[model samples]
Target: MIAKPLAKIRCLKSAQCLDETTEDQIDFEVDFVFPLTEFDLQFVGCEVINFTRKIIERSQPTPKQLIGLAHALHALECLPAITPGISVEYGLQLRKGDDEFAEFKYWSVSINEESFEVTSGGSVYDSSVGSDSYSGFKLYVEAGSYGYRECSDDSYGWIESTVEVLNLGGVLEVSDDSGRGCIKGTDE
Candidate 1:
């Protein structure tokens, strides 16, 4: 099958502050589009923080920033092109956000168009959400990096959130801010 260009893929991520004690986030949905026969989709999520520092005006992300976004987009959009019947793995990394700038990185699994299931094994973190085992599709960027490349480390303690597409019959495990864990779907 001919793989579609990156431009053909549709991506949506939003971030906002709901209140002082909580933040509103929307990261995943069904019917998400996947392009590429065997590529990766990075920079697919977003987050909303308290806006601690002054953000540079009119300054779009730098080449590094654009790369982080493009890299993630490429990885996620092509989730269906990887080896069929096999789970694909991805790695995401980002530098600490300072008053000046932040660094990011993304290493993702192959795509498999013949299948709709895309599984990713990695860690995610943020203030609102604690870290934990993460795997799911439909990543939502509520604020930081808008689901772009982010730093990963065992020292970060727990994973914040991870977005992945699972073929029907797969499983999804997630953790929330209150430090709760939940599993979705069951293999029957």
Candidate 2:
């Protein structure tokens, strides 16, 4: 499942673009400060304030959350001029179990910026279908002549990152590191 931005957070705040009519500098910074507690985040709500003074819904966030948000926002800030119709794409190679020898299946692809959040508990797969199954999720950013072969299955295995936008370029390959079922693509 895709991670939801802190919608319940009430104290945290951020600043980014000045206006929708104006361009957002990639260098623009977004910051947040929230109380740290183990239980409040799980049961209570958190808040987020943006640059436009817009108070957005944010859930209890961790330090990792801040880092992920910063990375995604920074990448999107550095957009260059492109053809009007050009699009960005993302992909993932996912499988069950920690060991490479374990049963492996499923792949996920997305172009929506919201699909790159890195939070956990998004239901990457149906736990009931397979017991003792583990899966790893990866994010890819691609652009230009570089793209993955079109896939017909949108019912992908899982999505690992939701807050971070992917950069779609260079190579799109995934390996178990054990040399099992490694997939790679090179842009001509």
Candidate 3:
């Protein structure tokens, strides 16, 4: 068993927007090679947000981000090395989109009843969906995607998108808009 990477939030957080219009966010996304390629689990990507501010990087990641990354890496690591994209093997199930096909390179870490699963093909999972328990926490890892809203308290907030947790070819590397931040799977 591997200890989850130590990722504690670096800033003060609130349960609700406190007069401030901006709130930080974190998202999780995992990428696999076309679905059923035979290979070993490479890495899990995680990211943090400071509302377009220069504050997140591989050195400092939030637990909300790390936890989801940990779980995703854990589940997929259980999968035996296969040569195809996503195949029906063991408990691993391949689900396709309902209407048409879309090019979604990453899968969202969906949580239900406190458990998590890697899924895509809908709304491209992000922060707003399961952000109740995650302070400044969001996962969809859609690069450069954010959702803005007026909080009930009248303050505004910026919800950041996903963090790609699994990449088959190599680590899914990402950078913030400022180009000063990056998200990677390794603690180093």
Among all candidates shown, the one with the greatest TM-score: 2
- Per-residue C-alpha lDDT of model 3 across residues 87-160, encoded as one tens digit per residue: 11111112223333322333233321112223322223233343111122222211111211111221122212
* TM-score: model 3 vs. ground truth: 0.19
TM-score of 2: 0.22
**Backbone clash count for every predicted candidate, in the order shown:** 53, 32, 28
Candidate 2, poorest ten consecutive residues by summed lDDT:
47-56
Candidate 3: misplaced stretches above 4 Å? 1-59, 81-188
Question: Native-vs-model 1 lDDT?
Answer: 0.26
For residues 1-188, write the lDDT of model 1, one tens digit per residue.
Answer: 32234322332321111111111233222222333221223332221010000011112335543333333233333332221122222233333434444322222322222232222344444445554445333322111222221233321211233121111111211111110110112111
Ranked by lDDT, the better of candidates 1 and 3 is 1
User: Which runs of model 2 end up more than 4 angstroms from their true locations?
Assistant: 1-56, 77-141, 149-188
Report the Cα lDDT for candidate 3.
0.22
Task: Report every candidate's CA lDDT.
Answer: 0.26, 0.23, 0.22
Q: Write the per-residue lDDT of candidate 2 for residues 67-174, one digit (tens) a residue.
A: 333332232332211111112222222244443233333332222221211111222333455434333443332222222222122213222122121221112221
* TM-score of each model, in listed order: 0.18, 0.22, 0.19
> Which of 1 and 2 is ahead in lDDT?
1
Better of 2 and 3 by TM-score: 2
